[model samples]
Target chain A: MKKELEKRTVTGPDGQTFEVEPLIDYYCEAHPTVQPPAYSKIIENLFNWARSESIWILGFGTGCGAIEMRPLMTPRFDAYRYGIQWRPTPRQANLLIISGYLSVKTLKRVIRSYEQMQSPKYVIGLGSCTINGGMYWDSYNTIKRLDDYLPVDLYIVGCMPRPEALLEGFNTLKRMIRAGNAEGANTYAANFDWYKTNQKRVIHDWDMPDYNW
Target chain B: MQQFEWIQIPYSLLTLFIVLNFGLLLNALMAKIAARVGRRRGIPIYQNYIDLIKNYGLRTSITHGIMFYLGPVFRLAGGVGLLLFVPTLYGSEMFSNLSFAGDLILALYFVFFGALGMALGAGESGHPHAAIGVSRGLSQMTMAELPFALAVFSVALQYDTLTISEIVKAQQGSLFHWTLFTNPLAVAAAMLSFLGSMMRPPFDVVLAPQEIPIGPPTEYHSSYLALMQTNRMIFPIAKIVIIMNLFFGGATNWPIFFAKVFLIYLFAVFVGVVFPRFRVEQSIRWFLIWAVPLGVLAIVLV
Candidate 1:
C-alpha cells in the first residue's frame, strides 16, 4: 500500500515534486497569527438569517472535500430540512462550496463558475486543505490559500473538516446573512492584492506551464 | 357544457378531415420557408407528405417506458383536437356543427400536453445530456406558458365565451381587422410567449444540439426517432395554424392565412438563428421577472 501510494505523485503547476506529506506538515505550521472574533461573529450571524438557514449548496464535489459534503446532506445530518438542497447550475447557485484544494487546471474553471453566479453569491472554503495549501503546500499545481485567488467567506479548520465541523461553518454563514452583512462577498471583490500576488507568483514560476489557454 | 349529438357520420368525417389535416398544408408551406430561412436546400411542397407516409409505414422502436409509446400518439391526437376546436371556415360547416364555448382552452392544453409528452419521453431515455435538455425544455416552457396563458385568458374575457367561433364572430370585419388588433397587448404577449413556448430560439435551450446532442432525444434512433422528428415538424404547424386563426381569420382565403402564419414562423426562425439558448435558471428568471409582469400589463390593458 505504501509503495502504491509512493508511486502516486501530485505535480504542482510549477512542476515541483515535493513529497506530499512533508509539504502538508510544513504548510500547516505557517498559520495566521490573528483570528478576528468579529470575523467569526459575522460568519455566525449570516447563518442566523431566515433565508440563509435553508441555503442550497451548488452540488460540486471536486476533491476530498467533496466526499465530506455527502454526510452533511444525508439523513443523519439532513441538510435538506434547513433548505440546503444542491443546485445543478451555477446561475441558480447562491453559495459555491469548494470542498478542498483546487488544481491549476480546475482553478480557472472555478473562477469561471464564480463569475457566472449572480451577485450576492458567497464562497465557502470547506477544509483546512483549502485554507493555506494544507497537504498540497508545495505541490506546484495546488493553489495555496484559495482565498488568495478567490474570495472565500468562511474557512473551516481540519485537514478535512468533519461533517459536524462543516455544519458549524454553515451556521456561521447563516448568521452572517442574517446580520445583512454581505461583507464577505464585498471583501472578496475589494481585496484583489492576494489574488494578484498569487497570480504573479504562479505565473512567474519558470517550471509552470503557460495558463493563457 | 352542453353535449352535442355524436351520431352524425358527416360530423366525424369532417372532423377527421379538418382536425387531422388542417395544419398539414400550412406546415408544408412553413417547411418551405423553414428550409429557406435555415439556408438549406428547401424541400418540395409535397415533401411533408412523403415524410409522413414514410414515417407511418415504418415500425417505431418502443423504448420500454410507457411515455415513449404514448408521446407520438398524444401529439397526433392533440393536433386533431386543436384543429377541431379552432373555427376554420364559416357557413360551410363540416362534421356536424361541433363548436364549444371553451374549446380554445382545450386547444391550448392539447398543445402543451403534446409538447410535454415529447419532453418527458426524451427525458426518461437514460441519457444524461438528454435529461438536461428536457429539464431546460420544461423550464423554458414553464416561462413561455405564463404569457401565453395570460393572453389566452384575456381573449376569453373579451369574447365572454371560450369558443374560437365566438371570439371570431366578435371580430367580424375586414380580414386585417381582428381581435389581435383590438387587444394589442394580449396579442403581443401571446406572440412573445408562443415564441419561447414553442422552443424557438433564445428559448431553444431544451434541445441545443451543439451543447448537448439534440438534448432530450439524444438517444433516440431509427424509426422511433423519426416519429419524434415527424411530430416535431408537424406539431409546430398546428401551433402556427391556431395562432393564425386567432390573430388573422383562419378562413380568410388560403393566401392571407398562410401569409400570417408564415410571418409568425419567419419571426420564430429569425429568433432561433439570432440568439443563443439561455441557461435554465436564467430563462426562468427572465420569465418570472419580465414576461409575467408584461403578461399582467397586457391583461390589464385588454
Candidate 2:
C-alpha cells in the first residue's frame, strides 16, 4: 500500500531529474464546515444571504469566453446590479470563472489560482470548450473534460456565451448559494488525491511547491 | 441622575450602533445615486449590512502579522471615538456620549490616529501595493488636513474658544447666522478639503478599485475587511459632523442632523461621479494650488 503511492520525478529541459511531491500526499485535509451550525440557524441563514449577495470573482480570464465578461461590466448587462465584482488577486476573491478552452499552460496557473483562494469559494466553467474542449476536441494541449481536474460548481454551455447568458448563469449561481448548495471548494478538499492524480497526468513540468497555501 | 452612570455604556453603544447603521445606509444611498447618474441600476440601500455580515462569515483569512490584526481595531476605535467625542444634539445628554473626553484639538488630532495606524498596519501587510497606497494616502492627507486645520483655526479665533460645543452654540439662533453664510470662504475651503479627505474621486486614487486592486486593504479580508467597512461608514460621518457643527450650525434635533449629514455626504458623491480620479501627485497639487489659497484667504478674513 505504501509503495503504491510514490513521489513523482520529471526531467526538465536542462536534463535535470527533479523529484516532485504528488499533490495528494502533500496537500489539503478535510476541514470543519465553515458555515455556522444548524443550531445557530439565524446566523447561518444570515451568512448564506450575505454570501449570496456579494460575490467577488477572481480576474483570471482563460480564453474566448473572456470577451463576454467585459460586456457584463458595461451599461448593457451590468453584473454589479447583482453585487458581482471582479477582484484582481485570488487571495481575496471567492469565485473563479474558467472561460472557453483551457490550454495545459493556462491550466497550471488556474490550478495554482484555485488553490490560493480562501475556502467557501467556487469555480464556474464556461463554454463547450471547458465542458468538452469544443473546437479543441482533438487538440493535444487543450483539456477536454475540466471536471476531471477541478470541481466545477456550474458549467455554462456554449461556444462563447453572450452576456445575457452569463447574467442568467450568475442568477443560477446566486440561487445555489442562497440554498446552500454550492460546495465546490469543500468537495475539492474532500477528494484531493483523486483530483491531483488527474491533474498531474497532463503537463509534465511538475516544478511547483506542494501546496500553494 | 445617579443611575445615568450605569447606563452610559449602553447609551454610548446604542449611539455607536445607530451611527454605524446610518453610515451604511448613507453609503448605499450615495452609491445608488452615483449609479443612476451612469444609467445603471445600483445596489439595495441595505447592501452594506449584507456585505459586513458576509465578510464576517468568511470561513478563512490569513494575517500578515500582529500589526495587521490591530490595524482594523485602531481604525474602528478612532471612528467610534470621534463620533462619541462630539455632542450630537444641542441639549440632549442621552446623545452627548463621552464628549467630556476632550475638545476640538483632540478631535482634530484623533483623525490622524486611524490613518497613522492604518499606514503602519498596511506596511506590515507586505504587499507593495499597500505600501504605495500608504505613501500616497499619507502625503495627500498632509495637504488635505492643512485647509481643514486653517478653517478650524479661523472658527476658533472667530468664536474665541476651541471647545466644539461652544463653537456650536455660537452658530445658533438665526438662519443667516450659520458660518456657511457668515464665513462662506472658510466653509468653501474646508468643504474642498472635506471632498479630498472623504476619498471621493479626483482624490480616490488610493482605492481605485480596478486600477490598483483596492490599494491599502489589498490583503485584508473577512472580519478585518468588516472592521474597515464599519470605519468606512462612520469616519466620514464623524468628520462631517465636526465640520457641520463648526460651519453649518449644529442641529437642534435628530431630523435636522440626518438632513444636514445627508446633504453634506451628497456633495462628495456628486463630485466623485462627474470627474475621473487624479493621480496622487496631481491631487496633492490640486489641494495646494486651489484649496490652499482659499484657506489662506478665509484665515485672513477672520
The numbered model that scores best in DockQ is 2
Root mean square deviation (Cα) for candidate 1: 23.6
Model 1: per-residue Cα lDDT over A1-213, one tens digit each: 233223346789999875554333222222112112224654434333433644546666656889988776444675644445565545435688888878876775676566545345678887776888888888978887777777777788887778888888877887776665544544544554565466566544322211210
Q: For residues A1-213, could you state the per-residue lDDT of candidate 2 as single tens digits?
A: 234346878799999998875545454433323343345778777777788899988998998899999988767777888888788878778899999999999988999888777767888999999988899999999999999999899988987888888889988998998888988887887777788888889968766653565
The lDDT for every candidate, in the order shown, is 0.62, 0.84
Q: List-wise, what DockQ does each model earn?
A: 0.01, 0.43
Off by over 4 Å in 2: A1-42, B1-6
iRMS, all models: 26.4, 2.0
Candidate 2: tens digits of C-alpha lDDT, residues B1-302: 12237576777788888888889999998988998897877777877888888888887777778999999999988898888888776666677666652378889988888998899889998888889889989999999999989888888888888888888888899978899998888898899999999888989988777777778888888788899989999999999889888999988788898999999999999899989999988998999998888889888998
TM-score of 2: 0.90
Q: What does the lDDT read for residue B229 in candidate 2?
A: 88
Regions of model 1 farther than 4 Å from truth:
A1-213, B1-40, B53-62, B95-97, B175-177, B252-255
lDDT of 1 by residue, B93-158 (tens): 452245577778888888777767777676556568867877777777877888878888887787
